[model samples]
Target: MASPSSLLSQEQIQCICLDIFTSPISTPCGHNFCMACIGGYWDSSDVCQCPLCKETFYRRPDLCINRTLKEISEQFKTRLSLFEEQYAQPGQVPCDICTGSKLRAVKSCLVCLASYCQTHLEPHQRVGTMKTHKLIEPVSNLEDRLCKKHQRVLELFCREDQTFVCVLCNETDHRTHNTVPAERECTEMKVSFL
Candidate 1:
């Protein structure tokens, strides 16, 4: 059986509007959503229904803030705020794996799709397989660093398109384009100006 902690991740995604979950509530159908999200959804619709399950309620359900879920969500939100607080500083990234008050991320692992502070990053540095994962300076929105089409890390720079490319992109769409590792492209561009 999956733990509640594991299930909470899915619940958070279901409750949030724009990836921000606040004020969780449950409908009669046992579907959970944010109070604001469901309220706004129903206020604009003719029938009150579960957005996810599509179970219709002819009358508005007497929705109250789900106490247990609200508490759990609050704790999660608190920790999340701590995680984001570090990233608010200039040139810093938040450690996505942090549990409590998080420190500034020192590096981002492309394979992990996560940023880590120096302490949290110890495993990647010590583990052989993890060491093979590309570690770059901490950057936010690590998903954006992936090639949208290939869903691979954008490691190569396509000089023709002036955009980042994944390995598959180099094999397919960017096969004819002049390509180099982004680091090498940066160095070459710097030398050209000097």
Candidate 2:
């Protein structure tokens, strides 16, 4: 059962600033942006246009912040903080991106080789390229998780060798070895144990 905070989609709550919503204002074209972000954008532009969709407006949109969005953003923020504090207890891996006081890592990216908290994991969830990064349960010592010989994530389980292996390892030393994705091997092992 996933926790309430685990269900939060950062992609929806965030604005153009790449941060959580602050004074969320809606454009006439129905796109939402932070008040300061939109204000500065309009100030630098020659015409009033939607930053997204590129729809030009005859006149500037109202500066009023959307009360509903503001309330939702605030609620989301509160829940996020509560969740972060709860997970910050000892024995959990801390987020690599967080400074000062680090929060517990929610996911670890095999590609980035770094762990992330809920807040710091936004880019992987939102950005197209980063979305492809393989994320697994938070684990400490990410450097040790890599295959030393190949310098790649140990994402494969070499069934013949009974060891974790990497893609490059399969191409070279493990060419004849029976291997599968580490996740599949884990599931198979769990079922056998059960």
Candidate 3:
């Protein structure tokens, strides 16, 4: 069984190489990797190891193109570019360190430099199809950025406390926080603020 930390969900992996040319290719481990990405990762290894699972195997595997994935990548890239243009701020957008695409300020972390797209987001927990990547919603709030008490980036929001705090907060101070759905939080907050 693959542990949460060991496996990268397919959706998250697909998001990473949305800008790259991706075709489905299987490794000897019976796992799929974006053809171009795996080709580069394989260039130096004697046996290709699954990047996510670390399962190693011999022999050249099949190169199969998943047309659906390729199409999704193309459409995602187009949408991302349009989103960037629509939300451009004066002189702030920079190419993300991981994906090398212009950051659209979708998510940010004070501890982790600045902004990242869905591609470069880090997974806090691996769920089903989409790994819930940990990220800051607005990506920029200089004042209440890092937790004042814990000095950690506020990742998850506590519905009970009506506050944003790091995971550590859940383990400690806000352990008993009666968290509600995020949509509930948004709906309530929106109405209150308006």
Q: Number of the top candidate by lDDT?
A: 2
Candidate whose TM-score is highest? 2
- Residue-level error in angstroms, candidate 3, position 31: 4.6
**lDDT against the true structure, each candidate:** 0.81, 0.88, 0.59
Tell me the tens digit of each residue's lDDT in model 3 across 1-194.
Answer: 12222333335435225434467665566565678788777787887677877886666565677676677556555655565463436665442544433555556545554665544454422444333433456444544666788887666679777787777777898888876544466778899999
**What is candidate 2's lDDT per residue for 1-194, written digit by digit as tens?**
23445677877878988988999999877889999999999999999998888999888877899999999899888877676574657888989998877878999998999999988999999999999999999999898879998788898999999999989999989999899999999999999999
**How many clashes does the backbone of model 3 have?**
0
**How do all models score by TM-score?**
0.52, 0.56, 0.36
Clashes of each: 0, 0, 0
| Count of backbone collisions in candidate 1 | 0
Question: For candidate 1, what is the lDDT?
Answer: 0.81
Compared with the true structure, model 1 gives a TM-score of 0.52
Mark the regions of model 2 whose C-alpha exceeds 4 Å error after superposition: 1-87
In the range 1-194, model 1's lDDT, one tens digit per residue, is 12334445634545647544567788899888888889999999988889988999989999898888777767766665655555426666778888755578889999999999887899998999998888988889899999899899999999999998999999999999999998899889899999
Better of 1 and 2 by TM-score: 2
Instruction: Give the clashing residue pairs of candidate 2, or none.
Output: none
